[model samples]
Target: MDNYTPPFNQSLPQTAEGVPNKNSLSSYLPIRTKGNDFDFDAVIGLVLRGLLRKKVEGYSYEQFVADCQSAFEEKLGEEEFWQVLKEMYFENKDIFTVSPELLLFRAQKGEFAAGDSRVASMFTNLLQNMRVEEFEAKLNFVEREMLSTLREKMKPDSSLQASEKPYLPYLSKAFREDLKFLASRPKYLLSEIESFLSFYGFTYTVQLSLALVDWRSGQEPVAKPLYFIMDHERASNERTHIKNHGYKLFNESATRLFPMLTMLEILQPSSSEKGAIKVPLWEISKGIQESKLTHLKERLEKFARAFKSQRNLDTVLDESDAALDWLGNVMKLALAQFSIGERFNINKRYVLEVEKYLASHFIQNRGRSGRVLVLNQDYIILLTNLVVGEKDKLRFYELITAFEQRGIFVDKQTEQELIKFYERIGNVERMSDSGDAVYVRKTI
Candidate 1:
C-alpha cells in the first residue's frame, strides 16, 4: 500500500495558480455577468448555510432542491435551478455536501476521473452518519457514569442501570489507591482510566445488545473512533493521488509503443510461441483506459516509421506480435499499470522450449476459443512448465502455489481448461492418481 498522502506535494508551502482553495468557492465558481444578474452568489450563500446547519445529515436530490428553493425564495426554472446548483456544487464542494445520488451518478457515468471509490467516499462521508462517533460517545457516557458513581460512593446493585452501577467498589481502599495512582501519572495519562473500565469494542451481551469494546487490551475505546476517521482520510487521499496522476508515465510509453504495436498486431495475430495460442487483436485494447487510445499519436508515428524502415525480416518479435492478443495484453497492462518510465521497450521471449514441444508433436494451439480470462490461466500453466522443465513435473497444489507467488492464479473453473489443453498436447500429462507426470508424445 502507498503511504497515504497527496500526490502533488512538489509545490512549496504555498498555493499554486490553479489548485482549489480549501475554504472558498472563488476558485470553483464562475463569475457572474452584467445583463441577467441572477444573484447566484446569494443563492449559493444560503445553500451553504443550510448545508452546514444540517451538516451531519443528508438529503435526497428532490428534498435538497425543494429545501434550497424554500430557503432562497427563488423560482428558477428546472434547467436554470439545476444549472445553478451544479455551479454552486463545483465552487463550494469543500464545504457543501452534494447528494449521494449525484456523487454515485458521476462516479458511475465516468464523469469522475478513474471513477475512484475513495474520491466518492471523501465527499459521501460528510453527508452520512458515522458509526464510530456513536461508539466513542458510548464509551464517554460509560466513563462518566462510572466516575459519578464512584464519587457518590454508590453500592453495586441490580436496581441501577448497568451503566450507572460501578463495576469497581466505590468505598474500597484498593479503588482509592487505583485512583491515586491514575492521578499521579503524566498530564496525558487520562487514557489510563480505560483499564478501570472494560473499554473493549466487544463485551458481554444481554437480551438487548449494548455498545461495548475491549478497552483493557487495546487503545482506549473512546479514542478508537478518532483513529478510524483519520485512517479512512489517509487511505482516501492516497487513492485520490493515484487516480489523478497514476497513468502519466505509461501514457508516455504508450505513445511510444502504439504505432509499433499497431503494425505488429496486424503482422502477427497469434501468440509469438509459433502457434501456441491465438488471441484476437481487440482483447489487448480492452485492457487499457479509453484515454490511452489517442494519447501518444504524434510521437508514436515517428517511432512507427523508424521501426518499419529498420525492420529485419528474420528478426523474432517474441510474444509482442500478439500485442493485441492475451500475451501482449497482459504485458501491456502490467507495463501501463505497474511499471513507470518514459521509454517504451518492446521485447518478449514467451516461448522458451519451442523445439522440445514441437519435437514432442505439440504445436502451439492456434485454435482461438477463449477470452482474456482463459488466456491468462493457460499462460500461467505454460510459464510454469517452462520454469519446471517438461521432463519433470510438479504436483497440482505446488504448481498453483508457484503461480500465486508470482502473482498468477490457476482458478478452479480454469482447471479443466488447462487439463484439456494438456490432454490435447500429450507431452504435458496428468499422472492419473498422482496428478503429476511427464510423457514424451506416446512413451509414458
Candidate 2:
C-alpha cells in the first residue's frame, strides 16, 4: 500500500501554464478514510482535530458522523460509532457536540439500532416547506446554499438573524434547526457556571502538551494566541442571553491565560441586549502556571507587558484568509520579543564569552531568561564566524572589561563551557601572561 499522505502535502490544482487555479484549496479537501488505508492514527487525529477544532460554533451531524465512521474504518458499525461519539461528547463536553435534536440512542434491535437523524429530518421538513414539486433541482440548490451560508456566518463572535436577515436560500432552514438544537437543553444551559468553567479550564491543558514542547524548544508559548482569540470572542458573546435559550453565558471563564500586554486593560464583553446570546468564548482567566511557578508567571507577565508590537489588535473572524492575516500580524508583532531570546529562563550564570558577543549582535531586548547570551550555533555562525579565529589580538582584561561594561557577565565557572566548545572544534590557542591572557581564533 502507498504510504498514506497527510493533508498538508496535497498539491494545488494547476492550469496548463503552471499557475495554481484561483479556486484551488487553501486547506486540503477532507476525504473519507474508508478505502484501503494503513495510517490509522493520522486519519483519526486529523479527523478529530478538525471536528473539535470548530465544535464551539457547532457543526453538521452528517459530516461529523461521516468523520466518526472514517475514523474507525468500516470495522465499527456507523450507528454504533455515532452512539459512541455521542456519549463521548458528554464525557468531554467542551470538545464534542451532539445534536440533541436527534434521538441518537433509541433501541432498534439488541444493542445496535439504526437511529434516524433529526438533523436530516430538518432538511426534509425544509424541502416540504419550500413546496418544490421536483426533488433533484431543489435538493442540490438547498444543500449547497445552506453549507455556504453556514460557513460564512459561523466565524468568531458572528451570528445570523432568522427574522430580520435578508433572504438567502438556506438561511432560515439551516439556523431554524440549529436554534432548535441549541435550545434543546435549557436545564443544562442553566447548569452551574462551575460546570461550564471546568470545561473551559480543561481547554488550557488540551493544547499544552504540544505547547510546552515548543516552549522548551525556543518557540512562543503556543497556547497564548489560542486563549487570546478565545478571549476576543467571549467578550463579544457575553452581552446578551442566548438567542431563544433565555440564559447568559457565565462570562468569567475567559480569564484563563495571561494578557499579551500587562498594562492594557482587558476589554469586557458587550452589555446584554435582549434576545441575544453572548458567544461562548472558552477562554482562560489566569496565568498559565500561576500557582506553582509564581516566578515563571511574573516573567511571562513582564514579557507580555514589555512586548508591545501588537498595538492595534484585530478581530479574528472565522475565515482562513482572516485567520492567516491575523497570524501574520501576530508573529511580526512578537518579533522584537522573539529576537531577544530563542529560549527563555536562563537559570545558569555566565555563558561562553563568544556566546555573549553573538547575543549582543543579534537581539534587541537582550532576551528574557537568565542572561540569554546567544547559545545557538546557527545564530553564532551567522553573526560571528569571522571573529572566531582572531583571539590573539584580543586582550583578557579588556575582554573582561567589555563584558562588565556591557553587563554581559560570565563567572569563572562558565569558562569550562567555552573551553569545551572551542576544544571540540580545535585550532585555538590560550596563553597567560602576568594575570592577563591572549587568545587567537583558528584560521578557518
Candidate 3:
C-alpha cells in the first residue's frame, strides 16, 4: 500500500488511433484503495481546502480533480476518500459563482480554473428568458444614474429646479474631460471647440450668423448675444469689400469662428417638439466655457495659412507642396461636386475645365525670357484665387486655350506635351461616356 504512489504528473496515454485518453475515476481507484488507513474528516478537510485553494488558484476541471485526489490521499486512505468525494459532489453542485476580481486574479497568476458548465448554461438560459425591454430598462437605469452624476458635476452656477434635470446620461469619458477643460478656460480653446463640434454635427447657425456681421465690419463683436446686422453699415461694407476684393470677408470670418460656434451648439440641450428643455444647452455650454481646454488654435491657424498659400500655387514644385496641394484639391473638388447636387458623376466636365484653366494660367504667368519659372509667394496667391472661384474643367480648359490663342505664346508644344504629361502622371481618366460611366466599373 505504501508503494502505491499514483502517477499524478505523468502525461495520459493516447489511444491506438493517437487521440489522448481522458482520465476517469476508475483509473485512480486502484491507488486510492491501496493506500494505508485514511482519516475521512482530515481527507475531507484537505479535499475541501484543495478545492477552495484551486478555486482561488484558478485550476482547470481536470487539474482540479487531480488536486482533489492528491489532497485525499495525503489525509484519508484511498478507499474512504472516494465515498466522501462522491457524497459532496452530488450534494452541492449548484452553488458557485465567479467574480471579475477572481477571474483577473487567476489570469494574472496563469491559473486555468475550469468554471461549472452547468451553472453557465443555466445562467445563460435565465438571461435568454428575459424580454429585451426588461434588459433595456436595466441598462437605462444604470445610464440614468451615471448621467445624473455627470450632470451634477457639469451643473452651471445658476440654481436649477428639480424638474429641470438632464435626461441623457451616456457621455463618454473624453466628453466629460472636455467639459471640465472648457469650464476651466478663460476663452474658447480648440479642444473644447472640437469636442463640442463633435458632440453636435458641426453646425453653428447662431455663431455663423453673428460672425458674418463681424466679418463685414472687419472687427470682432462687441458683446455676446450678437444681433444680426440686417441693414447695418457693416453689412454694406462687407458687400462692397467682397465685390471689390473678389472674396467674401463674411465667409473667411465664418470659417475662423465656425469651430467655436459648432461646439456651443452641440453642447446645448435638445429641445422637445413642444419647445421645452429636453436638456438645457446653456448648462452644457457653461460647463465647457469654464473648463481649461488645451490650446491648439495657433497651430491650427498656422496650418490653415500654409494650406491656403499652397492652394494658390500653380504647380507644386516640392514633394511636400505637391502632397499638400493634392490633398487640398481632392477635398475642394469633392466639396464642390457635392454642393452642386452631383454625386461625383461625370455629368459635366468640371474637373477637366479647372485643370485646363490652371495649365493656361501656369503658361501665361511664366517668365517670358525662357528663364526657369520660379513659383514665388505671389504665384501661390494667384492660384488661391483661381481655386476659390470653383471653375469647372471646361472653363479651365477655355481659360488656358484663350491664353494660348493670345500672343502670350506659351510654348504650344510644351503646353500640349505638358497636358499629355499631366494626363499620364496624374492618373487623369477621361469619361467620354455618359451617366456615371467613370464609376460603372468601380460599382461592379
C-alpha-based local distance difference test score of model 1: 0.26
Off by over 4 Å in 1: 1-13, 16-372, 376-382, 389-391, 434-444
Estimate the Cα RMSD of every predicted model relative to the unseen true structure.
30.2, 28.2, 33.9
**TM-score per candidate, chains pooled:** 0.18, 0.17, 0.16
Preferred candidate (TM-score higher): 1 or 3: 1
* Tens digits of lDDT, candidate 2, 327-381: 2232333322222332111111112221221123322222221112122333222
Please report the candidate that would top TM-score against the real structure: 1
Distance from true position, residue 32, model 3, in Å?
52
The sequence of per-residue lDDT tens digits that candidate 1 reaches over residues 32-139 is 111112222222222222222222122233444444444334444465655564465434542122121122112212222321222222112222211111111122
- Model 3 per-residue lDDT tens digits across residues 296-386: 2222223333433433323232223322233233223223322333322322332233123212222212122221111222332222222
Q: lDDT of all predictions, in order shown?
A: 0.26, 0.25, 0.26
Candidate 3 displacement at residue 189 in angstroms: 48
Model 3 segments more than 4 A misplaced: 1-58, 90-287, 292-444
